[model samples]
Each structure stands twice: as structure tokens, then as C-alpha cells.
Target: MSTIQRPSRPCKECQRRKLRCDAQQPKCGLCQRARVPCEASPAGKRGPKRGHLDALRNRLVQLEETLQNRLDSEQHPQEHAQALHYSPGSTDASQSTDFLRGDVGYGDPLPQAFMLPGPSMAGDADTLGLGPFPFPDLAVSLPQIDRGTHAELDQLYFDRVHPSFPILHKRRYLNWSKSTAKSRSQTCLQQVMWILATLLSTQSRDLINPLYSRVKQDIDLIIMDTGPCQLELVQAWTLLTVCELMRALYGQAWASAGRMFRLLQGLRYHEIDSPRKDPVASEGMIDPIRTEEKRRVFWMAFLIDHLLSIRNRWPICTRLPISDHAFQAAQLGSSTFLSQAVTEPPSSDTCSFNECIIIATLSGRGLLRDVHGTISEAYGGSGQIHIDHDEWLNLVLATRNQALRQRNDSDRMGTFAQILGQVTEILFCKSLMTMNKNSSTESCTQEYRCRVLRAAEKIVLFAADLTALHFSMVHPFMFIPLFVTAEFLYENRALGDGAFLTQLRSLVDVFGQLTNVNDHERSYLDLLSRSCQQNIAIMPATTCVELKRIARDFLEALEDPNDPTKAQAVASADLSVTHESYPSTEGLEQFLSGWAKAKQFMPNFRMELVDMVAEVDASGSGGKVWVFSKVTGGGGGTDRDSIDMMSINGEGKVWKTKDVQRITSKH
Candidate 1:
């Protein structure tokens, strides 16, 4: 009975082309001629189209209904008995509520207010084949260590790991451990501590996977439940991240770091207020110990986030949100506490490990923040950023001085800080090199190269000394220095400097110790060792003597004849270089041309004549116009034969040169 709608006008394309249309079924005659399909205008809508507003309105209505239902259930549970029914496995409601409020309970379910997903509905056939959802079973059983073993591991952690991190309050933690039965949070922490201690003390991965999985599972449950992000929870997760990093599970470590970052944010730890004035604490209760602990935990999170950001090449997440005054106030408060503790009358059993750790942490934080800021400023601009060489050098020197001071004052902790400082210098130098590589106005100069090589040498010698001292329970931070030094040595081996080759061998030896604990370490060692072997394969016989000597020293240091890889490196080093030969003047010219094209020729390019040869025709009518010989004279470790020959056309032009085995004979 309704009037029919009229057809719409033709499409814009046909109109634009000024084409006449017979407006056929799917195509017009003009469009058909042009081999383009005709598309008609869409029919006009009678009303406005549905869009985001409509969807939002629908969602709001559903939420309103849900709220109404929830209120009704609260008012009269009998009205929605089936909906509010508790499963047999669920804990008492009061217990769940108390646990949600952060009271100690192991079996309580998360409060309903948190809005976590419930267990799968058995009565619903829709989700029958999807399998059980994660986090339904929050219960986890952890492996228990004996009392003696626990104490030993705790001591091990304090002795080795605590000096570097020092976030945990040993006395308070020990007292708490003795006073209370283990809670879920405490259990998770214990597992993490044990895993770290074992790794540091034994350098063994026997307990790593199982313990790591257990802690991970617990963390997942806590996150899913939207549980209170307590300090203990934060510490547990932070340690878990460290453990992941130690195992070279970078992706997993990064994920853990992200979660830790969010957890700290949820706790408002980044607000940077004096702990005594923390708004989240009770109105009148200002527990200085708790305040200090919170500050320590926050700083730890900041440090971890910064390191992860650098490692992952992502933007840092721990940017201070509060004013400078607040940050200084927080730092000052911690420093005051540390100073008071250290200046107190010393007992025979008193240990200043805690104070040393706090000072070192504070110093390291300041240094790292400065480095991060400098780098960000250097690279944050739109165009090319030119580094002030003097300014850069001063910064490096200052960092080095700080590290040396840290190293000179204390024992292992100082040593740790010292190594970190050295690594910082190496990182800065590397940054400069990278900037130079990418700079339009500036290129890598000899001075910068020398700085990098010097930094690398320092790192290598320090690592070698540390390894020789058997202080090889090396922390995760040390890995960067080791890896970077190896990379620098490998890439610059063409310099033909015996010292560079020697350091490279030493780095390889240091890596051998690390390979047993991490797959990444093992992989890196293998790759670098192979690279060294490859360089050795093409090295000139004249340069082989020093490299062979270095290789023998490294092999002897290994003290294990069964290590096939080290033995193979020794054998590769022992390979005799074949006789060298020099090319004719024509070949030299050809080499120069190719070298220019490759951009391999530097301003200081030096060519050493290793060999020369000449041949004459039997009739003596044709002179020696072509020559082939080996030459090695680049700063970077390239050694190859080259060909020099005169033009076959007899134009009498300059001699031409090409790389070994590349150019073919024309006649």
C-alpha cells in the first residue's frame, strides 16, 4: 500500500566524466565503454544512521539493568537465590571480604566488587567446549625448603643479591617470618628468594623453571583477582622479573616489568611524596620503617623500569609525575635514614651492608637518571644532534670517577657499583658512536673511536680480573658490558691490533663461564667464537703469531681439555696463512676504484705491500701486465688477495685493481 521509492541519481564518477548513460541494470553504456562498472547512488535514509552513540546507549541500558539487579540482590538475596548462590568450593563471604581488605587468608576468593570473571557455568552449553578459564583455581602449592636450607638460602641472598638491590629489610623480614605462619604472599616471595639465591650461589638452573612457574602462577591469580597491590606483592613481582632476566627470558621479563609498573602506579607509589606524609596511609599513623620500605620499593621499580626500557629500546615509564620538591624530599628522607643508621654506635655484630646498599642505590639512581636525561635530550630533537666532544668527555670522566670511588670504599657491594659505573661509561661511549653513525654533519672520528676502544678495554680487563677472582656470580647488569665488549672486539678485528685480538679472546673466555647458566649467553658465545674463527681464517700469516699466542693463553686459562669449542678456536688460530702476493700497478688502480665505491677507504688508509710477483711470456714479446697478490692493511680486520692488471685495449691508462677472485681474464 506504500508508495515505491524512486531510483537514485547516477554515481559521481559518471557525472564527472560527462558520460551519457543508458543506466543499464548494473552498468551504464558509457561506463561499459570505458571498462568501468557503474555504481548507483545509495538510497537516502529516512532517519539518521545507527552509530557509536547508539551502541553506547545500548551499553548504558545494559549496565543500568545490571546495577538494578545487583542492588535488588543486595536488598533481598532470596529474590535472586540462583544468581547469588555460592559454589561449594567458594570460601565464606566474610573471609573473602577480609582477604580482599588485605588481611591474611590463603583460601578466600576475591571480593565480588573487583568484578573478576567467575568460574565457567556448567549449565551453559555455549561455553562447554571452550575448556576451563584461567584463574578459576587460585590455589597453588609451593615446594617447601627445610628450615636449615631456608636460612642458608636467605643468607646467600643477603650476601650476594641484597648488596646490589637492598630493597628488603632483612631484620624486619626475619622477625616477620618467625612471628607469622606463611601466607600466600609470603610463600610467593619465599619461592622467588630461593630461586634467586640458588642461581647466585650455585649458578644452577635445576630449580629455576619449576619455582619460576609457581611464582608466575600465583602472580597471575593475584592480578586476575584484582588483589590489593601490597608492598610484598610488588617485591615478589620485581624479584620474579629479575629471575626472568637472569634466565635470559627478556620478553617475559619485560612483561613482568610492565605489570610491576602498573602495580606501582595502582599503589600511587610514583606520586613522590615523603613516606611519612603518604596520603594512602592512615590519618595519624606514620611508621618510618614502612615509609622507608615503600620508598625503597618505589625506587626499585623505577630502576627496573629504566633498565627494561633501555634493554627493550622503549620509552621509559617511570617518569616522575610530582614536582621536583617532592622528589627531593623523598630522596632526602631516605638519605637521612641511611645516614642516621650508619652513624649510630656500632655493635660487634652490626653490619653496614644495608647503609652501603642504600647509598650505592641512591648514587646509581642519580647517575642513571642523569644518563637517561642526557641521552633523551641528545636524541629527542627533530634534526641532527651534534654532541659537544668536551662536554661528552667530561660526563664520561665524571661517571668513571664515581664508579672508582664506589669500588674503592667497600667490598663486594663497592665492586658491584664500580662495575656498573664502568658499564655506564661504556654505554655512553656506545651512544656517542651510534649518534656519530647516524649524524649527517659529523662522522665517527678517531677520538671517539679511541674512547670506545678504551672503554671496551677497561671492561674486558675488569671482567677478566673479576672472572679470575672467581667472583663470577655476576649480576644481570654485568651482562651488557660483557656483550658490548665482545661486539666491539668482533666488529673491529680488522684493525690487526694484537691487543684487540687478545681482549676478544679474554671476552670469549669470560662468556664461557656464563654460558652454563643462560641460553642467550651460550648463543652469544658461540656466535662470537665463530666470528673470531672466521676472522682468523682470513688473517695474514704475519698477524697470526700474536693471535695464536693469545688463543693459547685463553685455552690454558680454560684448564679444561674437554672443551671442544675452545680447542677448535685454538686450532683455527693455528691455521697457517698462505703465502701473500702483490698485484701490478694496474691491479692497484682497480683496487683503489673498488675501494672508493665501497666507501671503505678512510682518510688514514694505509696499504702495506705484503707480496709481489712478475711473469713474462715465453717469447718475451709480452711483458707482465697483470699481477695477483694478497694484501692486508685496513683498520678493520679485512685480509684478502687483490688483482692488478693493465687495460686489454692497450689504451695505456692507469693500472686497474679488483678484489681477489672477482675479475676474470679478458684474453
Candidate 2:
């Protein structure tokens, strides 16, 4: 520990710490006292190299020249592009904005999962330390939205995709994303929940396509993974099926649904319906909530299977895992079996996922099942099968009752439950009538005919209930069945009562006011509407109301034959005469042609007549009419006009354009 004369150069340790080194022979005094080895460098060993100043000057000179060149180019687009070097692995401008932002520094490679459906980092996989990046790949940058944004999506989902539909579990899924687990299946689930939320969100437009595409890629990887089945993956694919169905991608939805169902079977989700644990199965130790999730997912898939079958008019791919009418109260017997099928027991009276599944199952099996059957019974299956009329009626009634029961409960399910039931009965009668094309009224099922006519009126009232609400956000189940109801009403207009054509006309107008958020059944909507209008043009329509009900400064005519009929009598001060809203024969043909183009773009739109006078004599001659207003849905404000209409017994015959003339009218 002697303090000798200081060495010219300090020991490496002293130099590193900028401390004085004692420079003793064995070791620096400081190093020796610290019991550490130290090596002192020779003088000037680490000094600047000879001519370093000159090299520094030269480097500065080079930088000055480069700056001068850049300035001389003035950052021309092409010149700037050549000057700024991009990372070799950088891709098109479409890289995610909310994720993976900024330059990808060297060695900071994209995770194998994110790079999927795209190339990876610049070098060979081994060189970059990723090594083929492994299938059932780990670490994709699954959604990393801020808590606020994530929360908003959760709200969006619960708000729009009602829990009663049962595609996903809210609390479980949101918690899973926040979990520390980064397994491949976890990534798939996280990505799909993100996509579902994005698809449901109104403000997240840009995120949908990217999220959708990436989730699909993640799903493909999960399906190919050799590891054990993951419940989360099944759940992800269930939500994915919904996404596809929402976009009307039926083929993709079907294929995805099949894969998901197979995965569900692989995981033995079908057997999990019972609460008892199986001794030999790994699932014996599964979290109780997870078991509940499996059931929810199974029911969700069951519903999807029935939906696909109904939409396609084909047999259900999932088959009848349980009885089609397994919903019978006496059979199920106070079990609340469907109640346990969800994570939470349904919130009291609101229809649960089980309710939805039962209705879909019954509709698919009864009315639409072998839908081509007629007279003796041939609703479908190309008439190869036969059932007794009493048996057939029983089936229809069971489905009808179940559906009506859904409607009777709180509509917390969003779409009206009554819609499904009424439409089923309506379509049931429609099928019988359609199949019995050659049969007389006596040969057809009278009860079914009556049901069809009643439903035609009932479905309109059901839809009318949707006014003033955000119709676009409602489920497709609402519009799809409503569309079916409209078509049925149109075809059976002849069998309708006094108000039948008016009701038929009212239902037909729904085809226009109702804006299907998703482009579902797009192919047939327009054509069905045109045919209904053409028929209404030829069929007789009589609307009777007291004149006191007609409001001032409004014209209610046959214009906008597509707008949901607002045949409601307007409540006004004057009680002069009765009112009727009818179209001018002179304008009906022209109105038909321009319906789509002239129609207002309103999502929750409906139209109601405000003021009018029906002055036609019992002789049914054309007459002059006066002013009225029509209250509209969705697109705000009223359509006020003055019109004089003319008509006759135009039923069952095409009206020539010259048959009626436009009388004097003022707006």
C-alpha cells in the first residue's frame, strides 16, 4: 500500500475512472488496495494518431461538400428519394399506422407472426437470429391500442353486437388480450377481437381492412399449427365467421365456420355441455369459465350453422346436435339448460343466446327445411320427403311460438324476436302457396294462408316500431326477415283483406326505407321491390282516413313507392273531410323508374302521410286531390307537396300510360 511516485500513464482502471494511479510495480496502489489486477499502458499509447487533426479537417471538408450538393439539388423528389436510404426490408406505404411505426433498426426484426403474408428482414433467417421464424409462430405485434381506444372498442361491441347473439364473451376476451401470455393461439384471439371491434366501430374505418387481413393470416397459421387445440382459437374463428357474415362474404363465412366447428370438435367442445369433469381428459382441470365459453361458442356456431342453412336454403352442416324443437318447456323441464350455455346467466328477461339459437334452429328445420314442400307437405328437399299435415302444422306452430316468445321478452337482443316468428309463419304460408301452384284455395292449408295474411300486416307494425332509432346499427336478422315478409306480402296481395293491398304496399315501402348496413341479399332486393311496385301499380289500393287528420302544406302521393308506407292518419286541427294517400296513375310509371335514384339516403328512414283528401266516388273514377306533408325517417324534415291523382280498377291488368291524366295541382 506504499504511495510511490505517480506513473506517467495511469493503470487501465484509473484511466477508465479518470482517477490518479499510484503506479507501484506489482499493481497501481489504487488497484492493489482494491485487490484487482491492472495494466498501465505506455505513454501516448491511447493518444491521438499522427495527422489526426488533418484527417478531422478533411472529414469536415467532405461533410461540407455533401451539404453543398444536397442544397444544390434543392430536395427534388427524385433526388431526395435517391439520397434518403430506406431500410432494405421496408415495404409499401401501407404498413400499419397504429402499429410498428418508425424505422426498423438493424437486428430489430419484425416478429415472424407479423411478417406473415409478407417477406421478413433483409438477411437470411439464421443470420438474423429468427431461423425460419417457426410456424405456430410466436410474437406477432398483436393489437396494442391505448387503454382508452381498447375500451371504446369494448363499448362498441357490447353496444352493437348484442351479447344475446353469443359470438364472444366480453369480460373473458378483453381480459385475455391484456394477459401476459403470448402464445400463438393467444395472438389469433387477440387479433380477431381487434378485428371484430374494428368492424363494429364507426370511426375505425382504416383499421378494418388491415386488421381483417392480418387476423385471417393469423387464423391460417393457427389452423396449421400442430400443437393441441386452443379454445381461444375456436373463439377467434367464431368471431371471424361473424365478421365474414357481416360483410356478406357467405362463401368465406361458410368455409371459416366449418374449420372452426372442426376445431371445436377436436377440442371436444361438444361434450363440454355437461358440467361434470371427465377423469381422462385434459379439460377436467380447465377453468370453469372456459368451460362456459366453450358452450357459448358451441351455441354460437350452432346458430351460425342454422343461419347459413336458412340463407342458402340448404341442410345445416352442424346437423341437429340436439333436437330441432328441443326447446319444448316440458322436455327441457325447468332446466335452464340454454341458460347455462352462456358465461353469464342471461340478464333476467332479455332473450339469451339460447333463445336465438332455438329460433334459428326451428326456422331452419321447419319452414325452410326442405322448403320446396307443398300441399301434402314439401317445404323443401325437392319434395322427396313427406310428413302428415298435422305434424307439419305442429312443427310450424312450435317454431312460431318459440319465435313469438323471443319477441315477448325484452328486446335486449336488439332485433325484435317477433320478426323471426312472424316471418317464419309468413314464409311458411308462402312456401305452401308457392308449392301448391296448381291447387285451388280449398286444397291449400287454410290456417297457413291465414297466417301469411296476418303476418303481412303484423311484420309491418313490427318494423314500424324501429322508427326514430338508428336502424343501420340493428342486426341483419331484422332486415333479412323483413325483406322476406315483404316479398311474401307482395305475392299474396290478392288473398289480403280490405286493407291488404294498403298493408302490402306499406310492407313493400319498407324495402326502400330500411337500409341494410351490410350489403346482404343484395342481388334480390331491388328486383323484389320493382316487382312489388309493378303489382301495386296494377292492383287496387284504397286508403281511408278522416280529413281532419290531414295536415296543411303537404302532398302524400304514390311517389317513393319504396318509402315505408306512412298511411297513418295525421292529427290536425281541421276535420273537414276524410283523407287518402294514393299515387297519380300518370306519375306511377315515372315514379317507379326513378325510385332508387330519387330516394333519399336515410339509414333509419320511413315515410308517413300528413295531409290529404280522398274524393273518388264509389264508381272509381279519377279525381283531383290537394296538399299534404309526409314525415320521413333517417333523412330529416318533411316532403310537402300538392298533387291531384287519378285511378280506376287497374287490378289484374297493366295500365297504359294514357289511361290517366295529371290533374291541376300546386305544391
Models, CA RMSD each: 27.7, 26.6
- Give the C-alpha miss distance for residue 15 in model 2, angstroms: 74
Model 2, stretches more than 4 Å misplaced? 1-144, 274-286, 310-350, 367-389, 392-407, 412-415, 434-446, 471-473, 490-504, 518-667
Residues 1-667, model 2: lDDT tens digits: 6755556777866663334465778776777875767776555446754565666677567667655654555544454433232343664444343124533321132332232232332334333232122232223222335567667766766666644345444555666666676777777666666566565443555556667777776677555333455677777888888777666566788788877765654444554534443435534244534545556677677767765563433222221122212321112212245323222323333344455665565566555444444433433335533557536555645544554554464443434556676666665555565555566766466666766677667778766656433433555445456655655555655564544556755654444344444432122233343333344332232222111112111223234345423211221112122123323323333434344444545444444332344443353322223333333442334332323332222121112212122222234
Can you tell me which runs of candidate 1 are displaced by over 4 Å? 1-144, 178-180, 203-207, 274-285, 310-382, 386-393, 396-410, 434-444, 470-473, 495-501, 513-667
For residue 538, model 2's alpha carbon misses the true position, in angstroms, by: 16
TM-score of each: 0.50, 0.51
Write down the lDDT that model 2 would get. Answer: 0.48
Model 1 vs. true fold: TM: 0.50
lDDT of model 2 at residue 240?
Answer: 83
Report how far off residue 412 is in candidate 2 (Å).
4.4
lDDT of 1 by residue, 584-620 (tens): 3222224334334433343343332222233322421
